[model samples]
Target: MPALRTIPSKAGADPLPSPPREVEPRPATGHLAKAVRRNLTAHGFLIGAVLCFAVFSWYPMIREFLLAFQKTESGRSTWVGFDNFRTVANDPAFWQAWGNTVLYTAFALVLGFAVPFVTALVINEFRHAQGYLRLLVYLPVMLPPVASVLLFKYLYDPGYGLLNELFDLVGLPAQQWLQDPDISLLAVVIASTWMNMGGATLIYLAALQSIPGELYEAAELDGAGLLRKIWHVTVPQTRLVLSLMLLMQVIATMQVFVEPFLLTGGAGPEGSTTTVVYLIYQYAFSFNNYGAAAALGLMLLVLLAGFSAAYVKLSRTEDE
Candidate 1:
């Protein structure tokens, strides 16, 4: 066997270059960059929507609020804080219109709320003729407001109205409908209920259908009669929907305008049918008093906000 050969060393010469420093490949563009781009693109629509709302909705609301505190002359405004509100408060017609509006809201709510719930319950009990009855009940809702108001106007005519004819047939006195200031609000309420109850009835009907059949069966087994079952099970089950409908009715009825405007020819005899919205319209367009109109609008906003807050609190309480 040959002896092991000695290996040579580069003692004087530069050592072989250290292995090239391990160069990590540069990472692709950072995740943060991509994430930022993705977020901007995804939220672009929301940003645009916010811009539009600010430009259109919020700006106008603020402008109206400011206008409410100012005095206007030939479309120019000067600050006069609280004066417009004072003027509105002092106007005799303001109180009158407010009273009429409150009365109309009350009457409309009572008829609108009760009648629809009753109709929904009755319709729900009938397995047959349900479709036909629903169609008939909802038919008025499909009528254009102008058309419905016009039809009711004719029906409420002083001399030749169908209501008068019916009264005569039933051996009752034929009283003036829309012509009488005392009963004109009631007449409008009746027509409004006829037109609006369809939508409410349908909503209530759907809520009623969603109630559990097991609850009804249990009630029956416990010797609950029909009314008892409804009072205990049906009413409780549908209470949320009922409360929501009640709030909706209050909001809508508070804004009543079109029917009374058309039927009574804008405020009816002795301004008996003048609602707050109607008065606002008259101030803004009819009289061109934008400052006063804006003040009234602010007042309405305050009222609606209070109502909305109450509704939210009530709903939260119910949930708790």
Candidate 2:
């Protein structure tokens, strides 16, 4: 009475395969939520920086632009259109300030631009005490600018000054540093060069170090003198750095303020040291002509911006 089972024959087809198991797909919501959180955190940091820039930098520039066209009087601001610009243009000091600023920039290019590169060259040749020499050169920059200027003020005194004493020892006539209009700007330029050249020297030194030693060796093999090596190998190798520094120096010197302001009492003898920025200061603070001040500032901003654009374009073209 039991049920009988039969096995498949050897030549028969194989038995059917078992059904495959079903697997559940994972949900993507968790991954999406994590991505959202990450984005939010990144955006939160960016928002803070953007807000700060908007409030501090962008707002001030916008306000200055508006102020350039408005006259403020009796605690009230009124639309003045081009009146501010016209007023500034008509002032006699305008031309003189521009002239002096140009002169200052010229002097700076002659001394400040060259001295740093020369210092860097000298420092690079030294095999010992290089760090000490660099520290010594940069010591003035580390000191408070006001303190350094005051120290120079004492040194530049016509009487009982170290400089005058040195001149006396050399049998040279005592000379006025800040009092004489003819040389006051030159004196300021010298002080500025001394104060600022340390940074440029370091920059040049870094650039010089990056140049390949093999090029220098090849020059030496070719019987190149020191000056010849500099002209052929050094100058071309650091041309980009030199050009950039030149542009920066010109821009900075054009905006000369602190040196002449402190050393020469802002105008020096016969308005010889009066610069564009100083004129702006005179407009805003001395004369209380805010509109004119803003106008002049706007002019300076436009000029520098345009020059920067042109310079950058030229550089790119040359590179290409």
Candidate 3:
């Protein structure tokens, strides 16, 4: 196309300014570059976390799911559908292990769940040495778990154990702590409680400290005793924490392994202490049946997941 000439400005008027150039736009990359530069470290950390979970957590879970449906022999894996599940179900130890696990969880709920809260309550009442008491309570948690278990093993010895000696001093019978199947699981529960209660106690203490003292004063004004005040004021105020801790304790107790494994050789006097997780260990390591182990592990996982979902739904319903 031919260029057209512009008309000249009138005399005494400023020359017409040249038409402004329409410069081409540069790439819209400045903001994007700044954003990338600002978040580079965060992105690096996030990617690292995702990779760790993928390799260490998610991959094993996926492998377990696959292994649950397959049989591996001499480095060869073949799909066998639900045969592994059937095998796990048919094992005689299966029901016994489940029963023992349920029983352990019940005992733990009764003892382990309540003891920490009670300790917190007692400690909260103390006007002096509260810090020392907390330290003393939490000391067990700081100790190596294996060392704690071994210490309990010595205290549980049938002959000349400190527990028996204490019983003797109290004019009670020196009951066998770890020898009888009837009491062996209970002994393990006691040891587990002693070992694990510290963290729970501290959590409970913190919750208790947050409770308003005026509630207790009001309860006392209503002629409530200590028990009445606790039942009416403390329990209701700490219900949420109690529920959460209860759920956590149930899940943890169901997976009881290290205590029974170390204290009573995982089976504990005719399998009284054989929990689901210990059974899984037995299947995988002792019996060399990884498929069965995976099947059982999957079952436990599903059950726990269902329980957690149901509990959460119930909690939401109640809140609503």
Candidate 4:
């Protein structure tokens, strides 16, 4: 018993070691097969859309060029070269339409462009009721364009319109809004702005929100008031969006048809509201001159392309 007590003993035995896990390498062919399947699935999903575009968009665009240069007589088609274009250019209505289009675009820039920007700025600065205000601003756009135009047409009636009534109540003379040639285009622009401003306003509001609050804070420290802060902090911050919206507004105004069309029978008093697109419509439907219509379309397409190119060049130059 004395000898056993003198021996040292271990407190615990060591645990057995666990076996290592075996890992299998993935086959290279498996990855390639997965990618192939993914691509095939994607293409399968896209086939319908691709077919639709080819049939509806691309094919018609190709046909427009063909129709622009071809004439049909006695159930036969023949090449007309530039004759269709010449006819379009020679028509007195063509130049008048161009003039009207340009004038409308100018007015649209003033009302459609500026009003929405201002509205967005005002709405964005609100600490409360922003959603309600924006919704109100955008409410007219929710109406169908035709409905909006017709509604404005009624509202612009000289004898019994609400606008005239309001003017009378305010001690201003009731004016012929859409009947007078001088103000018809202006009236159409106003109605178009009322109907269309919502989208642009929302876009501008979104752009305004993305601006850093620090910029306004910095401007304030520099004694900038509302106008100064807007000029220095807001416009500069949102210049890119402003430029884009400006271009979009120009294009949209250039194509204005429904408002002027519905409001003034596609041409205001003395053809004041007749735009290029309306002219094209007249050529195709009103007059049944398909070749001339296509030619006008081609001319419009060229002008828009030139304008877009010049705009891009000028904008880039200014940015540089």
Candidate 5:
């Protein structure tokens, strides 16, 4: 009773022995440790890649944009805002170049897209000499650009060109190929198509091979004719590849420079063959107007971006 008199009440006293202390979580080891290490390594690699991309790709793009807004005087750059853009917009040649570029793109796409797909389809359907045909089609793609363009230049020569010679033999009027400003671009397109179609043909051939043979066999058994089978089976099968190739061709055609440069000697007669890219070259290198060149480059970027967005939308719609 005496000891109890000094003792705290049950409610006030520690109702139970002190709760056991929680054990601190030990550092991970073995597999857990290995997993953590692997994660950190992967994160480090990703960070390094991001840094490289920022330094090499993003930084240059930003620099180019900034340069477009700057004017240079005797190696000193001064901020000029939209002045360059205004100048470019006011230039008549810009519109001409843009029109020419659009025309070239259209011609290239129609010729390039159709010819390659047809060639690929024909090659894929062949039972023999397929290898030789494939090789022959692809041979042009392997030639150096300079050599190919030069070869075309000779073929397109106005007076003694093979084309004119053939026209003479056939008693038809010998129209100027590269000499006439009106038809020079079309002539160049033909040459470019010949050289460029080889790669596209090979790509389409590969895509065609990937289609299931059963689809064709089934179509054949159902009394589907060749054209019907292609429309019902082949086209549907290679639609994605065809769409992707079309997009690529549009982009490539938009940036065309070498063919016009080499074949027509940089824009050709009366600037009829001058493309947007060639105009940019004239601004930057020919005239040394860096600001204007930058503006033109930005314009090209915008145009290409629009084209790319449209292509993506069309592709998505197709997928849906």
Candidate 6:
């Protein structure tokens, strides 16, 4: 029989030291470094857009404001705060131009805003031939503004114009269109509406198409008439889009220039069609008063910005 001997270490002796474990260090990057690199990548992607906005949008706006407060003489610029604004305000054409611009905006709101909406409604109700009708409405927008304005000028002539001829054919007395100061703005509005309404019509069509049929059905179930249904259901549904379009139309009409310029030589008979933008052109190009032009432009900019701000706030509140 063989017996195995048992071995034991001393109780107080230290155990054999273990081997050192392997540890891999991180890439020497911390959370802050990671965030910095991520932000750099994002900013690199946005640099092009930032530069474009700075150069075209913000820079021009700053320059406009600066020009409003400055005057250049003999190739030297002098700071003249409020002087340019006073000159613009004091000019006899200044008030007339503002009045005409306001009047033009009013006419545009009536025709430009309502015509496209009504057109969209009529076209949307047609299941067939919608495309054709829409095409006809949009065709005017394809024409160049210069050509359109010139054609309209000929049509609005007091003598031997197509419109006057049509009036004669219908056994109606011929009337002066652009020649009369009273209705010159109205005539211009009509031409502008014809030229510009296609885009608004298309936008309205898209908004109308987005509405649900169920809303109309519900309104009908409630014994609502056509007008009632439209008022209660359709208008409520499209209010947001309508408000947005109204704002855009206001901005466009306020900036009108080419039509009045080409149609009536920048100012209609008796200075009837002298819109603010047209007046600005006269100040800058015709009169060579850049300071006054900048001042007048700043005034318009402030007015429109205020109007838009108020409209947007009201719309947002209603939505909420």
Candidate models: Cα lDDT each: 0.90, 0.94, 0.93, 0.90, 0.90, 0.90
Please count the clashing residue pairs in each candidate, in the order shown.
Answer: 0, 0, 0, 0, 0, 0
| Residue-wise C-alpha lDDT for candidate 6, range 64-179, written one tens digit per residue | 99999999777777899999999999999989998998889999999999999999998999999988999999999999999898898788777978998999999998878988
Model 4 agreement with the true structure over 119-160: per-residue lDDT tens digits: 998898799999899889989989888778778878998999
TM-score of 1: 0.84
- Per-residue lDDT over 39-139 for candidate 5, one digit per residue giving the tens place of the 0 to 100 score: 99788999999999999999977877988999988999999999999999999999999999999999998898899999998899899999999999999
Clashing pairs in 1: none
Runs in model 2 with CA error above 4 Å?
A: 1-45
TM-score of structure candidate 2: 0.88
Ranking by TM-score: 3, 2, 4, 6, 1, 5
| Residue 204 displacement (Å), model 3 | 0.7
Model 3 lDDT tens row, 1-320: 99999877688678879999999886679878988999999999999999999999999999999999999999899999999999999999999999999998999999999999999999999999999999999999999989998898889888978999999998999878888989999999899999999999999999999999999888888999999998999999999999999999989988888899989888988788888999899889988889999999999999999999999999999999
| Candidate that scores best on TM-score | 3
lDDT of 5 at 302: 89
**Could you tell me which 10 consecutive residues in candidate 2 have the lowest summed lDDT?**
7-16
Q: What is the Cα-based lDDT of residue 282 in candidate 3?
A: 87
Best by lDDT: 2
TM-score for all models, in order of appearance: 0.84, 0.88, 0.89, 0.87, 0.83, 0.86
Those runs of model 6 whose alpha carbons end farther than 4 Å from true positions after fitting are 1-45
| Residue 309, candidate 1: C-alpha displacement in angstroms | 1.0
lDDT of 1 by residue, 85-133 (tens): 9988888889999899889889977898999999999999998999999
